[model samples]
Target chain A: MTPPPAPVDDFDLHGYVDHQLPPARREEVATYLAANPEAAARVADYQSQNQALGAAFEGVLAEPVPPAMLTRRRPWLGAITRIAAALALLFTGGTAGWLAHDSLLAPSAIERTVAEPAAYAHRAFAGEFRHPVEIWGDNEPHLVTWLSSRLGMPVRPPDLNQAGYWLVGGRLLPARGGAAAQFMYQDDKGGRITLYVRTGIIGNSESRFQFFDQQGVRLVYWVDGPVGYALTGPVDREHLLHAAQLAYGQTKR
Target chain B: MDDIAQQISEQIPHLRRYARALARDRTRADDLVQDCLERAWSRLHLWQPGSNLKAWLFTILHNLHANQVRKLKRALDNVPLSESHLSASTPATQMQQLEVKGITDALQRLSEEQRAVVLLVGLEEMSYQEAAKVLDVPIGTVMSRLHRGRERVRQLLADQGQPVLRRVK
Candidate 1:
């Protein structure tokens, strides 16, 4: 009437429950359990619980995708198509308007340089973080001075005095036509704004302004004399334009 | 195209069932399955020809579920930590029948990882190696999670006054 010694290791109990042991080893455990009622009862409880859990969730394997979600397309594909359409428009009839306007007001020139910044800002706001910006906002002075010199115009970082954003810094960038400048700014909540600038000639014309929205990011560009300025970010259209206007006022002064 | 689409269509029922079991709610389970199918379609290029598409789909679905759990922080307080008594309809029912509901509620309390491991091995009747592959974990981890998950459920049921049934050894 003596009980058998408890299995030296708990793994034997698991192995027995899971049927993981080789035939001979499993037989030994089975024979041992035959002599030990307490252990056998515990093992049975474990098995039943396992079965019930399986029954509950096994049904999930057969569920169908709802029709609405199935038809939903990838977000990136739509954005890419929009960008391609914009580029096509710029290259076709907008070329004359681009040439007649002042070099800084030329939409084509600004569009080429600002495309990436606009796309990046849109993505950043859309919650894509891996490549939010090529450079961090920690080197503001160098970014401003370097960008200013490259654009051949005295560039001053816009003072977001009332706006919640702060100057993070900037980085040099390669644009569609020439070297470009990207000045980065961040707000308290980690939202970001990028200003892209480049120099180009568009048939010697007067300065003008252009606005565009892509995937929730707003972009404002203007030709001032021979320099093109583009402001890109997730700010509302009015706010982004106001920021652009503020930058213009400071630079013109 | 029709054949591929048809094959995917055939698997939807089982996928729904598995998702329901995982989410425990009908709407959330369907949403999860829909998301899984969308991902599977986009990544169809990566699927090898003639392989067990069902297993591949399951792996993708499980990973997607895990990602959602992490992103939403859904697992943070969902674990079952206590035993609750099942409601009695007549109070004259057998003890074994009384504990069934408690056991199910206890299963819902397991961590997502433990629940997934248990479902794959215990319910789906998959081998440790196969379940490990689907879960993208080591077999040892799967075994350990399954063991812990099962023990917790049993302990919860026992605490709820379920009479332990002795198997004739």
Candidate 2:
């Protein structure tokens, strides 16, 4: 017996495997496969591959989430900033105390602008092939000093190599009450996540790790004293969330 | 909980299932799902009320998966996939020639787009249209990729040569 020529086109076969064919078209595929034992074997293989893929990770859903994963701890940068605040307090004795003290206080709600601007900046900048950032991270010392001087505070780009994100660079932008800095980070995979930080007065109390997704970009942001930081990515919410957490943690120190 | 929150919550198990299928490792999959949930919670306002929550969740998962695959691919670049020695060794399996390990190994070798296409269609049982939406690709692209992906998996499984109990055809 002679074997029939291979199905030159697989649109129908693929459609059949993916359940995309119309009823009549499905019948056509079935008829074609029946006469061709080779095609039938191929269908059988596709079916089994699907089964194996589906069954492969079935147990993962049932596994309990480790207790630690459900909760997050934020030291709020208490150690590093508090000590500096205390040292400054020792120098500025009484009259200037309240003013300096107020400056060190937790960021207020009105002062914290996280998701919208961050997402906005991500959309505006991250996709740009030419200029993703104004001051590239390669010029680390210069970038920090320039941004620090502009924001009227010492600014350091958050280190995120541990979290698999690297500081790519940053660009300055306008934000609520004052100037904002958007810091970009990229992984070896060429995926980019950005940290948007700004300083100014916000009237409301501090925000917890708030999240926002807009225009297909996801972000998580929070405000510490005198600084509002948001981590943005075009990736999924989870990735941005973790990247945000890492950014927050790294920036804290 | 608000309506959107409630709806988003209902999609978690399914999200976990999809993440697990995508990631293949238990810990990594759960981490992905958990991050997705927290992100979804914070971004609840972004989701249009009365929209398709499952599709939204799947989209989020796909984005996360894509990022991770890029990272993995970067790592794979350091130690080339060709050196993995997957082809020469096919582990014994009673059920069929290619078991979960072999299948997953083959999948890891496929391009991210191809993996997403097949898993969405095969594991999630999404229609070509739904899979296309999740993947942000056209229906024609989905079909072509699915065909290419399925064809590759077949070739890989055949090369792995797990002892199929019998060839039915």
- Predictions in order: lDDT: 0.60, 0.65
The lDDT of model 2 is: 0.65
True-vs-predicted CA distance for residue B149, candidate 2, Å: 1.0
Docking class of 1: incorrect
lDDT by residue (B19-126, candidate 2, tens digit) is 665665444566577666655655766887676678777887788667644533332232212212223233344336335468777786677678888888887788
lDDT of 1 by residue, B1-169 (tens): 6677778777777667666656554554665677677778778889887987877888987886665445323211221211111121223444455555565567567778887877766666677877888888888898889878878877777787775333343
Q: Which residue runs does candidate 2 get wrong by more than 4 Å? A: A1-9, A64-253, B1-3, B71-100, B163-169
TM-score for each of the candidates? 0.47, 0.50
Q: How large is the interface RMSD of each prediction?
A: 15.4, 11.7
* lDDT, candidate 1, at A59: 46
Which segments of candidate 1 are over 4 A away from where they belong? A1-9, A19-21, A54-253, B1-7, B74-100, B163-169
**Model 2 complex DockQ against the native:** 0.17
